[model samples]
Target: MIAANNLSVNRGGRLILDQVSFQAKKGRMLGILGANGSGKTTLLKTVTGFYPYQAGSIEIDGKPLATLKPKERAQRMAVLSQDEHVSFDVPVYEAVALGRYAHQQGLFAVKGKTDDDIIRKAMEETGISDMAERSLLSLSGGEKQRVWLARALAQQPDSLLLDEPTNHLDLARQVALMEHLTKLLASRQLTVVCILHDINLASLYCDDVLLLKNGKVICQGETQSILTRGVLENIYGTAFHEWKEPVKGRKQFSVVTRV
Candidate 1:
């Protein structure tokens, strides 16, 4: 399990996160929801040890995050950030291979058979196998996102962290990515914590959610409970209405009025 206990973060003397606490259980998807600048990305970075925190602790499977070595931590959890700026002109397959750096021996080391197998599995898992030979610069935004996801999957970690994984995706790509993620987590028993702006998507796919407002955790619980219209309104500062889908009867929340 990945957990944060009384976590806090500050940037340039300004507080970005305040005593945020939550637990992402094994074999479950935890959605982090909030309006822009609510510290959603800040929290993810803190959990990954990318940013320094002013207070509290992050624990992964009972081990304190700060105590783990870089490679050790990467082996345990993989992160896919929203602003993954890959300026290189490498092939898609080669970009995904970079995810295995921690597991590799030297800079000139050739990929072993196990590495190739895992890369192939990750590519197929993310539906990017056919794009393996394409250059990263040549693919569309959605395809690049899939390549990044495949890289993280190639890490073979127990936990996955994604920041806006659906950003810039078309409707079909978004659904495909979410569905693929759902199946991957369930079948592989991988713990997931994702930062999602789409509340409806979060409610549809996540097992639990953590809502944030102004850097503080406002609510945390099962998707159906925490994703209510009232809570969403409070968090987004907008009036919302809940409705059941005509075809599936699944609940969906939509903002209708400014608050």
Candidate 2:
């Protein structure tokens, strides 16, 4: 499990995070939801040790985040960034194999049979095996997203942290990615902590959610229970109406517009 206790970060005379606390448990998808500027991305980055926190602590499976070595951390957590616009001049298989870098002895280490198998398995899991010999630039947006996801999965990390993984995808691609995540959660014991902007998407995909407003947590708990219309309005400072989505019976939002 990944836990953050009283986490806080200050920057340029402003507090980006204020005593944020939440747990992303094993075999669950925890969606971090908030309005823009609510510090959702900052919190994810801090957990990855990319951004420094001024106060509080982050723990992975009861071990302090600060104590883990770089390779150790990489082995435990794999992050997929929203802006992962890679221009790497390599085949899909080679790009996915890059996820195994931490396991290699040095920069010149070659892929062993096990590494190749893992890489191929990851691509197959993400449904990108056919693109193995293809270049990243040749794939479409949705295909590239799967390649990136395959790359992250090849890390074989127990925890996956995604920063708006659906950012540049079309509607169908978004559903496809989220649907695959749901299947992965059910099939494995992996933990997912995703930062999502779409309220309906979070409601549809997240098992639980953490709501934030102005760098402070509004609430965090089961998605269906905590994501009521009133709660969403309070967090976003706007009027909203709730309705059940016909397909899955999940709650969806329709913002009340004053025109």
Model 1 TM-score is 0.96
Taken over the whole model, the C-alpha lDDT of each candidate is 0.91, 0.91
* Candidate 2 per-residue lDDT over residues 44-122, each given as its tens digit: 9999888999999999999999999999999999999877787667899998998999788977998999999999999
lDDT of 1 by residue, 164-236 (tens): 9999898888888888889988898999999999987887789999999999999998887777888888998
Off by over 4 Å in 1: 246-249, 257-259
Scanning candidate 2 in windows of ten residues, the lowest lDDT window is 81-90
Q: Model 2, which residues run further than 4 Å from truth?
A: none
lDDT of 1 at 112: 93
